[model samples]
Target chain A: MTSLPALPTPKKLGLVIDLDVCVGCHACVVNCKEWNTGGYGAALSDQDPYGADVSGAWLNRIHTFEVVPQGGEIVGEAGEARIVHFPKSCLHCEDAPCVTVCPTGASYKRADDGIVLVDEDMCIGCGLCAWACPYGAREMDLAAGVMKKCTLCIDRIYNETIAEIDRQPACVRTCPANARHFGDLADPSSAVSIMVAERGGMDLMPEQGTRPVNKYLPPRARKPLASSTPLPKEDTTGATGFFAWLDDMLDRI
Target chain B: MHPAPSIIIFTTLSGLGYGLAVVLGLGLLDPATLATKIAHVLAIAMIGAGLMSSTLHLGNPQRAWRALSQWRSSWLSREGVMSIVTFVPLLWSAWVCVIESRYLALPGLAGSVLSLATVFCTAMIYTSLKSVQAWHTPLTPACYLLFAAAGGLVVASLFAFAGGGNASLLAVLAAVALMAAWIAKTAWRRNMLTLVPISTPETATGLGAIGKVRLFERPHVMENYLTHEMGFKIARKHAAKLWGIAVVLGGAVPVVALLVLAIVGQVSSAIAAMFACVALLSHIIGMLTERWLFFAEARHAVMNYYNG
Candidate 1:
């Protein structure tokens, strides 16, 4: 009897980012650039480097924010303080508009698992898919003249030759803070699933409803402020003693 | 929002074709004159050119035929099918109007409805893309229909006035369409200005945390495809000037010019026809600017990555 073809293993690789622990150091960004550049996997290309200006292509980056307290109890006394760091990358959305809008079948989600990817050979430089996307996750590789984005490191994660421990994506592997988790989300018992369950993870721009597969766990709340004595307001009155007396004498004179 | 020149010509030029064809089919004028036949032919040609121009936007032109199969969901497909349907009746009616003028009047009337339907379908194509909040409203399609009729009416009036076919009626119709066009323009502007982009940075990241998040630094400094495509923006002042131009040239000028000519009653038909052409051009310019701005003003959720 003819040997039956081995049943295809269903593997869905995804990333779970922990906002509470993400120090926004961008170590993951650096590591991603390094791994993606040299690997047989998705290669990220960069333009000008070490000339008048230096810029390298990176699959991910962190953003910092300072929201001015607007009519809230958390309002700081004028000039007190603020800052929030946000890391940006593709959510690998399930209902990816980028994929559907592609004229060629170049951009497609794997049916066995929901990882959205761009087939480099098929994609033309046409940027229709980029326009269709609300999340702005897809980026075009200028050198190749085709669309590019975070692949979740498809090559590294699936290589049978590599050790199981080394199979995770470069970004996830290099996260010094352990802020990023990589795993099969379909398995409820997975660490990423437990983290998502314990902390309520949400989809970005749920109103647009692209149904992004990646989950971002909200930052944990800080402890309540301890009571502290308020500082007195500054007196606009002039300096004491000689200046004060001189001003008084001048007024009298 | 990239104003592909081909698409701009397609939409604007085609608007004139379908608009004029409608009036010819309506039997508003005497069948004896050859002007109706000429007008309908020109309109049909413009429609064909517009359809042809749209294909240039597709990456693989060979797959363009598959676009017709997507009418179940895609508005672009609906527009394609309807535009083709618009010609079937138009060609039939035009041939009959020339060869059997009196007998063909009924066929022309049937063609008029199809022309109007084609215009509505074209409008729906833009109105359906929910991501484009500016074009998502019901007013977009309504505006398209009105403008198409307005353009057609103006052309028909020209032919009628030249032939002495009740110049007063032509002027009055032009005036009414101009006024309706103005109202529609205002409504479209109101909807675009008032609607807010529903996407937020927090929501985009899928982080439900209640804290402000901003782009401190991008993943890369060099321009990426997402940045280049989504970062399309126009200044507020330029938008104001364009809106002003659209309102004045597209809206006010036509109404005032047509009204004055109608009331004067001296060479009223010719003046109304002139105003119709002028109004159509003005409306097209205004609509083009508005459409461009609509794309430029849209804030893609991805730009949140760059903190744009």
Candidate 2:
């Protein structure tokens, strides 16, 4: 049951995140938790809520990083010190190692939309799926004794009752910076696919060879600022004469 | 990886059990003898205990039966199915040797092949993980197989001594197997030390063009499931000490003990049996420590996000 599908789905639905404008805001993280808790996977429980070391299962997390220049510091003018706000979630990879490592057949990818999901009823919570995933996407739900993950908001995406535009993932819908975009990456004409083409969106850890469906658009280079003119030099040798002249000029004024 | 005691015990004890079962199935030891009967019973006990211990680590043990249905792809599932399948021939072999007082070549051979296959399946559970570079190697299974064979030989030697058979041959076999296991393990550890991580913080975030990346802040103030399960870190100093312990107890002690038994076994069978028992006990302890280190040292790919 853990075996991958023989033929991949024609439509590969995924996300394209732009790193150029992400403000490290936790709105997506908060919204994902809010929606998933009551959505398909309910009660994403928190343990010791008010304790000194509070912890819980979260499907999405945002990490901030300072990307320092590799080669030494820039000499004269300061080199750009880039800080990226990366939102980490399941890429829903085409060859997801997580799906194949599941012993209970709980983890699976949908053939229709290429969405990865877990059947909570069959999950034994062995945590092997989490171990198989290089992205750290899967989180074990201790309270329910099952695995919980992004699900890409499967319930919302497929629901007919919700407005068509709002039927995307909660994270993408609630992102204030508009950094997250969802569409069919397989379709070259799709906005997400076009953005990937234009911005040269990249895969995370391509060496892992998971063939991730999601892509990330790297931050654009910063524009150089125009230089300002130099200030006039002071006449230190004729300080007394200059003061006297300045006083006379002021009196005349 | 947290190196849960349940898993450690499961792998070590079950490996030893299966190894013993394989040796018994090979007809290397006389199945008609009382010594072989005692060994068979012990092997079954070890396997039973190990299988029982494996469930302790599961979040929901009641649903473990569901794990067997996914043998098509999952090594864990395959291991479960194989373990159950192996038990049939293994139990039949044991019954034939102990109750029927006979050694049926066919059943014994089937059990032997299945037992080793089960061990391979167990090792594959770790070997198949692409995220853990330390465990994803051909040497992983090789080491597991060698260690199990070595442990089985030691048990067989003890049984041979107890049943008034020639224990020297089994001791020599145990010694050779132990040496091979240790060598493979050393190679595996060497490979792990030099492994250039495939995923980095840069690659993980797809921001390598920016520059050298470092985590500015964590997403949450408190730990999460990922951090708890995958963020396990061991200090270099502690790991070095544990490695020494694993080598000495699991590898060196058994090798030397078996050699001593082989040489002195011809002199006094009583003394040889005592040393064989010593080797068995020490090897179990060593194997447990080794298994613990296996989980403790492995770096999961997800750790790249946590700056691990």
Candidate 3:
């Protein structure tokens, strides 16, 4: 059997989010916390629970937004609105400012995969990288005195021990809504790439020009305002006569 | 943006070093004197010490040597490399100045130019970080260079007054520099006062649609490290008070003091030295407060969630 190569071309690992199918559930968020807490590399720790204090570690979260009618190509009916649940995480920006701000080389974009990783050994907990990030993606592991963020399950995604199909990020695998897709964005033939081309997928804050790798496919147009099913004719005669007779008898009794 | 104590010390010390070098270099062009040699030595020592102090701010000082590797994209790396590159010439100039050799004087002049270039590069490091709005402007580098010269002039004035080496000219230069510093400081304050924070709730969330968004349910309850570091903010009222003190004690008072001494013809060595110390202390405190405000006042786009 041939041995797997030690290193590969820079893998542009990223997410492709489908807004059409997401049900606004927090399953991905909970699953991420569980998997990451017990994962091989880094752990997210929560400080307090209950008793006027509740906080838990999460790598991702689902945010619900009601996009009301606004001045744009997209618009709602006079009394209609659509609710979208956005799952937020690090974009793994092409022009990563966080890496540059790190006085120590602890925060670095890997040359092999372009994944931004922190060398925990060198991180001094200065938190300058956090300031440099426009997106509040990276969080400090207060207990560990190091920075932590969505690693895209670097260990799991490439593990040979796990089955090929199962070797994806926990969040992507557990997304019941099938809203999240993970793949190499550099490949023009990837499923995510095809979906993006078909559906007009766009990045958030394109103006900032972080060149975010993640793509959010806008909600596709509603299916031509489907015709309503006709209601049955009113059951007037028999029901009306019977009700009137029963009421009269009861009053007499 | 907080201008940590280590950084403040580093910049101030190195600035003085470069400033003194400028004046001493000018002196060399005129004539070779023992006084110029002493000044040259002093400048080298100051620059060396300041550079050493800067290393303390680094998380991994040992990896400092590796900073030269990424000069392709980073101004910071360029600064690190330039600082080292200039040092060799500086040492050479010091040697020539000490030995009083006309043969090496030309090289000494070249070293002085190199030193100024390195100082300008260092200033640009701060000027380049676009995120730090306060330090991002062209005025930033200009102010740094000018302030360094102003500090050097004050020191030189003290020396001139003590040694009776044309105290009048030095005092006049000090007075003029102090006034210019005062004007620059006022402009800096004005710019900061009007500056707005970049981060907003809509921006942080990457939603083009904007109205308002608050942290209805915070991702975490207890203060995380992000809150401790990037979430720092000072009340508007307190910042104003600090600014007032910074402007008065840091800017106005120094100019007035220097002018008063010069007008009275009491620009003696002791008085000039005292004024320099006073001005230095004022500027230091002002810069500290200004830097604090720089960080504190900046509203990170992340903060929009909290504020909204």
Q: Please give, for residues A29-85, the per-residue lDDT of candidate 3 as tens digits.
A: 888888888874457877665556645445676656554434322334432345566
Per-residue CA lDDT of model 1 for B125-232, tens digit only, reads: 656554556777888888788877776666666666566256567667966886797688678878778877676665565432555555545655565555666677
Give all candidates' CA lDDT scores.
Answer: 0.67, 0.87, 0.64
Candidate 3 error regions (>4 Å): A1-11, A18-86, A99-113, A119-128, A140-149, A218-253, B1-5, B12-64, B86-123, B132-135, B162-168, B178-200, B203-206, B209-215, B304-308
Best by DockQ: 2
Candidate 2 chain A least-lDDT 10 residues: A72-81
**What are the per-residue Cα lDDT tens digits for candidate 2 across B1-308?**
88888999999999999999988888777877888898889889999999999998787889999999999899999999999999998899899989987888887899889989999999999999989988999999999999989888888888887763568888888889999999999999999999999888888887777678888788888778888888888998999999999899998998898887777656666667777788889888889989988999999988888888
Q: Native-contact recovery for every candidate?
A: 0.36, 0.91, 0.14
TM-score for each model: 0.75, 0.93, 0.75
Ranking by DockQ: 2, 1, 3
Evaluate every candidate with DockQ and list the scores. 0.19, 0.76, 0.18
**lDDT for residue A83 in candidate 2, whole number 0-100:** 68
Docking class of 3: incorrect
The TM-score obtained by model 2 is 0.93
